[model samples]
Target chain A: MSSKSTTKRADALRSIEAIVQAAAECLGRNPDASLSEIARAAGVGRVTLYAHFASRAEVVDAAMSRALDRGNEVLNAVDLTGDPLLALERYIDAGWHLVDQAQALLAAAQRELPAGRIRELHAGPAARVEALVARGRAEGAFRTDLPIAWLINVLQAVMHSATEEIRAGRLNPERAASHITATVLAAFTPPGIPVPEPRGGA
Target chain B: MSSKSTTKRADALRSIEAIVQAAAECLGRNPDASLSEIARAAGVGRVTLYAHFASRAEVVDAAMSRALDRGNEVLNAVDLTGDPLLALERYIDAGWHLVDQAQALLAAAQRELPAGRIRELHAGPAARVEALVARGRAEGAFRTDLPIAWLINVLQAVMHSATEEIRAGRLNPERAASHITATVLAAFTPPGIPVPEPRGGA
Candidate 1:
């Protein structure tokens, strides 16, 4: 292939990355952001955007995929190897920022993607929680009376609820991570046991 | 009014009641159940069904309303007085039955109704939970460290997650209420406190 052709390919790839990044920012701020707004945010023209994505749904899907990729990166960095309770607190803290970044984009994705497709994309994060919960239960740090899957489900539910509370302005965003971690730790503590305190205290 | 006309009016009212009842049952069983299936369940002709509901969305809305009405009746009968912990257990038990009956209908409603409309319809139940959580916190039966609204939101989220778990065959239906009560009680207990045991024990 000619060097000129290779340069054109690199430029096209750069354009697509810029478009997806702008889409994630725009949709993350407002789920109803328009395609024109996204194109403008990317510093691209409508013709260029249309050259890539065919519709709003396609753009939203790409943005969602990018957000999930970013989420996986954040989640992968957390050291989940210590005491289950402290590890859970660390995970919740990181997870909160990811949720904060991707929430509005999630709303947009829900509108544009199939429910099963979204669930499929979430499998990675879910598996991480499942593994942690299983380990916690094995170590007797978490309750074993309830099914492992249900425990994981409850944790996810609480985090999502915290996000909603923040969105509605009922929860203080600054303290959301601590509140979530505290609530989840208590919930996971086995019955007849005293709920554990976080490193800095509740 | 003439006797013949009065009887005709009464019969029309009865037919509408039957249609709504059938709609609730059909949609409660299958969110994707067709209008024809609802008509069959109602023992009415498709023309009669169409005469009352202009479209499938209309029928689903009516069905959802009926289901919520039924849910209100069930919730109202629960004695929410005395011993906040026990009251919570009773509420969870009653709420589980309500969720089981209305889960599919809720799916149908989500597809057909505006999100705000559904949230509006849910105001009654949410209010009940909020009132109970407030009472529990004031009595020192529940934690006050977390905001009351966040706590209530977490409870609702856990309950919803339990319903999903049951639907996915991950949670045993018979054990759901106890699991929900136990998990919620632990989460609500103030940090450093030993989680309370349910009446029947966790």
Candidate 2:
């Protein structure tokens, strides 16, 4: 209605955006970051932050949702059809950014959110992996000897392990995708079959 | 020393052992188990428990040390010589019990112990895996394409993932060793080589 009221509304929305963005960056850097630290990063007063989020958990919840939303955009664009192995590589490459962000935010989320809630947020990404693995197994591209769930767990574990390797400075970030692709492909290849070569050149 | 004093010291030592053992079981069952609950489980009064452990962290640290000590006993007995693949299978089968125990205690350890301390406690087990992988690579039984650290991380991650799978009721514990061996052997095998068959019937 009134121009003055509209201006106030815009200002409030702008402040919320800034807080969430800064929260993502801050929590990504340090899971133990305090609300005061987040407020400082957002260039807002404690009062302003409190006006929006009721607690640190609320802030973390918002930050996690925002990060996942951004991640879904990247993941949704990857074509998961066609050759199972190739699709898997594309998924890993595209999903790397999300994995990086999620790994960073995971500590904070664990501290602030319920385990079930965190699992709920991850269900979509996980379902995608499960479906792809099932398809690969049916096509004989993946090992059928291990339970499908075990195979899926191994795939996720390898990716997470790669993230950790990068974090520990033992592996180059630039080379992570290729390394992950190589390791996972070999692991998933059916027994009695020669492991596949690394797909993309490191 | 007086005979009375010697008897008192022995009783105190036994009480301490009881407390630590009970703590391991309680924390294993629920990482968030309270000090009072631990005391109850130990069949000791609150006063007696606090007399020995000043705080929850102290109790957790003790429990972790005891668990690791017990785990080392089992892990130490596994002969790590001979065929790397076969050695690995033996290592997995023997280490499964330790993995089950350690996984249960990990949550409590993470909550009470410093990250560095936790890593330090794990360094022994981890180094064993690293050394084995290095040897495997040198012997051409494992791939040299990935970093030694990445390979070690994957092996550990897969084992932990298997533990999670069993916890989720998706995998039978009886089959975990076989599944872990199969997944890991395939992952580590040099590219262009056929993945190894599952060692030991599931």
Candidate 3:
């Protein structure tokens, strides 16, 4: 609790933050990036990295966890009480931001981690979306016959696909996010219902 | 030609077909499968494989070409003369067969093949899908607000994702093809239009 001890604590925290950020960036650029490369990018020594994380897997797990934490915050912030359709769109719009922020980590996580673990990371957001879909169905905003789980999966797939399109330069990033929101909303609209014009017209 | 010469040519053709099929199977199982392993799977010697394919790249390319040929055959068989919506469903339903048959090779192809080469391979099918989407739009069966190109991309993405879900055991293969067809049809239906229930409910 002394001033010198507090300073040391602050310095340690800063170094850890820098290392984690650099690891995410390095892995984003090259999923197979090495520890030394990450260390160099963080402007830290190997000793420092090893002191905080023991192995490459640990580093990857930490980076993914950090990314998921950021995503969860965005998912948490979407106002669930509003129009269920708008809430779904808001969640998806915010979801894309999280995707952009964790672009590199998301790809790396899929490649490097087990599916079960990846599912665990996504469970929270998936549940939130599931709730939104349930609400949409209740409000007659979404189809009632399709399984709720399938609808949620479609939303996730469309978002992931949009990310791929943007990365592949097939979709412009400016319109990609809004396009995903519109496509998803359209997909969920019930068979008997009329959908509003898709947002962000092509 | 002499009978002996004719027989020899037939045998050579059989060997090439066997080798290509084996290469695809092996690459599907292991993207970095050894040439010797592929030859063994084909019941041929390494020398024979090398004689037919100078390198692994040649083998991979040949396998991909073989898969694409099979896919083109399926695409060709879809009766484009029917109702545009039914034609689209038929194309999607049949497309799943190609996707299943080439699943392993497709994944390996993406990882090992150049993007330009992959794009070239997809060019034919993409054109077919784009034409179908345009037809659907013209028929007033699909939304006109979105670009035909984007709609085609969505169709491709949804199919690819459904394939992944099946691979991951999240979706039953029995229902996956139909589910995909339904999801795609629903996604394409224009605003103010009511699509019949999505094909496979669950």
Summarize candidate 2's per-residue lDDT along A1-202 as a digit string, tens digits: 9999999999889889999999999999999988899999999999999999999999999999888888877788889998999999999888875786677787799889986677678777878878888999999999888777777777777887777777767788889888878888888899899998886663
lDDT of 3 at B60: 88
Tens digit per residue, CA lDDT, model 1, B153-189: 7877888787787877788888888888888999999
Task: Name the top DockQ candidate.
Answer: 2
What is the per-residue lDDT of model 3 for residues A103-137, given as tens digits with 9 covering 90 to 100? 76777787677767887878888888888889889
Q: Write the per-residue lDDT of candidate 1 for residues A1-202, one digit (tens) a residue.
A: 9999999999889889999999999999999999999999999899999999999999998999888988998899989988888788888889888887788999899789976688778888878877888899999999998778778888888887777877777888888888889888999998888887655655
Best by lDDT: 1
Measured against the true two-chain complex, the DockQ scores of the candidates, in the order shown, are 0.63, 0.74, 0.49
Query: In candidate 2, what are the lDDT values of residues B63-160, reduced to their tens digit?
Result: 99888888777787888888999988888888776887677787899899986687678787777867877898899999998878777777788888
Native-referenced DockQ of model 1: 0.63
- Candidate 3 Cα deviation (angstroms), residue A31: 3.7
Give Cα distance to truth, residue A183, candidate 1, Å: 1.2
Q: How accurate is candidate 2 locally (lDDT)?
A: 0.84
Which residue pairs in model 2 clash with each other? none
Per-prediction tally of clashes? 0, 0, 0
lDDT of candidate model 3 versus the reference: 0.80
